[model samples]
Target chain A: MSDSTQVAATPAAPAEVPVAVRRAAAKPVSFGQVVGRSPFVPYLFLLPGLALFVVFFAWPAVEAVEASFTDYSIVNPLHVVGFANYTELFHDEVFLAALGHSLIVMVGLLPFSVAIPLWLAILVNRKLRGIQVFRAVYFLPVITSMITVAVAWNYVFADKGVLNWLVATLGLSDAPIHFLLDPHWALASVILVEGWKGIGTYMMIYLAGLQAIPGDLYEAAEIDGAGAWQRFTRVTLPLMRPFMAVALAIEMVNALQVFTSVYVLTQGGPNDHTTTAGYFVWSQAFQHYRFGYASAAGVVVWAILIALALVNHRLTNGKQANTP
Target chain B: MSERQVLRRRRGARWTVRRIGVYLLLAAIAVVFVWPFLFLLATAFKAPTQDVYSFPPSLIPRPPVLTWLHNAWTQIPFPRYLLNSLLYVLGGVPLFVLISAMTAYPLATASFRGSKVMFFAILSTMFVPAELMLIPRFLVANQLGLTNTYAGVILPGVLSAFGVFLLRQAFAAVPAELGEAARLDGCGEWRVFWTVMLPVVRPTLAISAIFGFIFIWNDFLWPLVVLNDDTKYPIALGIAYLTGISGTDTRTLSAGTLLSLVPIVVFFLLLQRQILEGAKGAVKG
Candidate 1:
């Protein structure tokens, strides 16, 4: 900041400027002057974290993109496949199936993860007694490990397990029907588990969004003789639009990338009906040793996610943008 | 009664009925939801010869016993697997917490060159499916001779993008003035963070730690892929081992799986409040 003045103020300035400016130039620059009066120690505090990001995230990404172009298949191992893998992936039936499953999962998870949870948050948002206890109880599965949750559910859904036991006594079916391992029931089983575990988390998020809205809006709605439905549609839903967009985006991304649940529950089995893009990618790359094809699949998943994100941004922001 | 009073009274009664209806709906749903867990628990306590199905879905076993738990213990190295899981979680969670916090602080506050781009790069990494990185990660691990070691499982998590993103949101809230004062007081950069900013984001740290514990403890795929030794098997892997075999008995498999989840469930019950509070505060914050 002071560099120009110091250069101009030199007493023996060689006709570059007048003596008055030259004198201003002679003052020395101190470390404090350069870095400001604040501590340089925070940067020191951040050094380790910065190094870790480099090792884990940055390094891994660089390697992954590079690996994509090659014949990085695990079975045959990595080679330079160029665009062959990408071209081949377009026609690959299993890859397409997995991609379709991922989309279905993302599209389906919204109501369970976001909508129902939002409803739950609103229900408990009342000034009722013991509601806080319900909040904790509902959120129990959210904190539990997915592996344990999935495994536990597997037993519960066994051919002769509790669910079947319940169904049999009711005479709902002739015999025990499969849940987790069944071709027909596997994906549905996954969805139920996903919803149970996720609803509580997004409920909290919706609560935050709800709390941010002014209480007076609802009070004013009441003053205007609006009923509960009217208040919700006019005041609550409109105000919550932005949060809905965010919550949807968050849950969509999470559901699309689901692995542990699918992995532990079915491993994309029952004729690969439940196989998601993530499992497909894992199998193609690691199990089958086809890294190039797997990388192509990864690129496809990335494309879908980015497209959905952009579309969501546009839909959410379009009205606001039009208003301005 | 006045008309308004009569209306409110009638409405209140109607509201009570509707609420009861809602409550019943929720209760029935909760029953369907929680039954699987109940089934597993009963299946765990049932004897081998006993039919695993619960008539009327008995949450309680008529003869609650430790026979299945005992069989599972003897059949597998149950204690050893539990120890391995505990060991991995112990090392993994703290390591992830510390590393993520460290990375998050600077990225949140720094004015270094390429800072915005750096932050975006990290955020974009979250968009990529984790499975996409598995082969490359395994390759790197194989090259480093880290496969089957704690290093393989631990390193990928230690510098988690999500953890960094989560913590940075908190750390960024530390006022610049407070940091300046600490610096002027000769605390150094380390002390300013440790003494001033660190305390402010303890909730975030706690939140991240809870998630880190869950993720590290429950990790199935990476552990399945990397850790090759039976001796190194974590509980999740052990549980998978029980039910994953083809044509397995519904009884023994269910029994073994339920026993495996007992520890994590117990942990969840103990920490449920803290974890929920932490998670709610975090995304909301």
Candidate 2:
């Protein structure tokens, strides 16, 4: 056949060609040749995700920093104000209180996220019948929407709800405590709700770690005459340190991002006791229409998170543990 | 019986008692974890005349009625909001999974330059707190004219570093021989990836899909910030709005909350195994 006829008669290549064509021909027609050769085939695969990361994450993150310095409203033209927003954030009492409350919630949630979940993990780790059922039940809250969780907790926190009834029946107090309405109790109640919802996640993480421990270790410990508590303390606790580090990191991230519960339960209210840093940022941006100022506060919060993460890293000796 | 036999019997009795004690502990903790939901279910069905909060805090609904559910259905655009949430989940999850897979494929198999850089870049995004990103992300969407649009919510959510990382691990764990076999058969890299590799990592995809579904369905703040119009509000936001209405009663709120939770809770029940395995693999992987 003539060369022109051969070129015309050859079948069109499929779109899903490989980078290195193995076609059995003297002159191979590779995808690289057909599509114009470049070393970016891998990047071509990465383009969609990278585009999203740039537009949604990198671009916005840059804008967050820029907005923190400028006086940009949604409607108004932007003006570079040179750290005025940051200065204002320092002076803003609500911002300070919000920062304080965020820290408080983080500290408060450690018990729920680390300690109680570890306890629950140990309890459920036993080879009991229907253990999976209990696990599934415990995990229900973690999967449910936060709005539902907040609403459910609302009933339990109501003045005449089960909690108050229990307290009264126990003679702890004669009068009902308005859990969500009283400033003294609102933050604690919100923290409790957040912690309750989060227990399952941490528990599952610990359970996985517990499951990884060989049965022989426990048996060996038993043979050594180590008591139950002693086995847990000496065997399980030492083995669980890495898992705890991972859980602690995850918990810190979740606790600092505590907005949905506050929004649904208290609206960060009863005199701003539950207004976490996350809520403060939202209120500034959406409610007060201070987008620039909110961006500044976001930067501050982000810095704090980074610092805390670094500290956690130092504490954990920068171990290359998997993050849950 | 001998003294040794008596000692063995007493020890056996103590062991049984300890097992019973363990069962009791599990039962009590289960009550603590599950009671709120039970209370919610009870309140949703209780009649308006029924005291939801009595001195004893009863869970049994006396003369359960569906009136509150009906009221909640009418009070807001519940069905529309449900559709919106379904739209978010349906639109967001597959794209999220696809993008995650595409990103992970090259990172897993490609020996090209800058692959590690790309991996670390994605990892860094994990540390960028979600709350901090809200304002700037909203602004970026506005600049792109995606504000108040479903694309706005779905597109940003498509890039989940956790999904990408998990899928990367999954994809890497598949033997290299599989890809080489497909390649020798004149199957292109894309074909090898799509047909041969994707199936191997199907479990990871399912795991990410379930998580993506949960996240998108329950994502309140991002959708709240992006979509100004209440008509486009997801179910979570709709429930929040319902909670805001002064006239919305407890029974109605309870009903609305229950309705909002059903789809994902049911999903969890159906796919609990995959999710729990996914959680475990996340640590181990």
Question: How accurate locally, in lDDT, is each candidate?
Answer: 0.71, 0.83
Question: Model 1 over residues A249-314: C-alpha lDDT tens digits?
Answer: 788788888877887778889889899888888778766877777777887787787788778778
Listed in order, each prediction's TM-score against the native is 0.84, 0.89
- The alpha-carbon interface RMSD of model 2 comes to 6.8
Q: List DockQ, one per candidate, in order.
A: 0.29, 0.45
- Single out the weakest 10-residue window by summed lDDT for candidate 1 chain B: B181-190
DockQ score for model 2, please? 0.45
Residue-wise C-alpha lDDT for candidate 2, range A1-324, written one tens digit per residue: 011222232222334435455344244332233233345667777999999989998999998888889887877798899989999999999999998999999999999988999999998988888888888888888888888887787668878888998898889987889888899999999899989998988898899899989999999999999999999999999888888988998888878878888987889898888999999988887788787888898889888878887898788875554322
Per-candidate Cα RMSD to the true structure, in Å, reads 7.9, 6.1
Kindly list the per-residue Cα lDDT of model 1 for residues B92-147, writing each as its tens digit. 88888887777677677656555677677666766877887776677777887989
- What CA RMSD would candidate 1 show? 7.9
Best by lDDT: 2
Best by the TM-score measure: 2
The top-ranked prediction according to DockQ is: 2
Model no. 1, DockQ: 0.29
Give each model's clash number.
22, 0
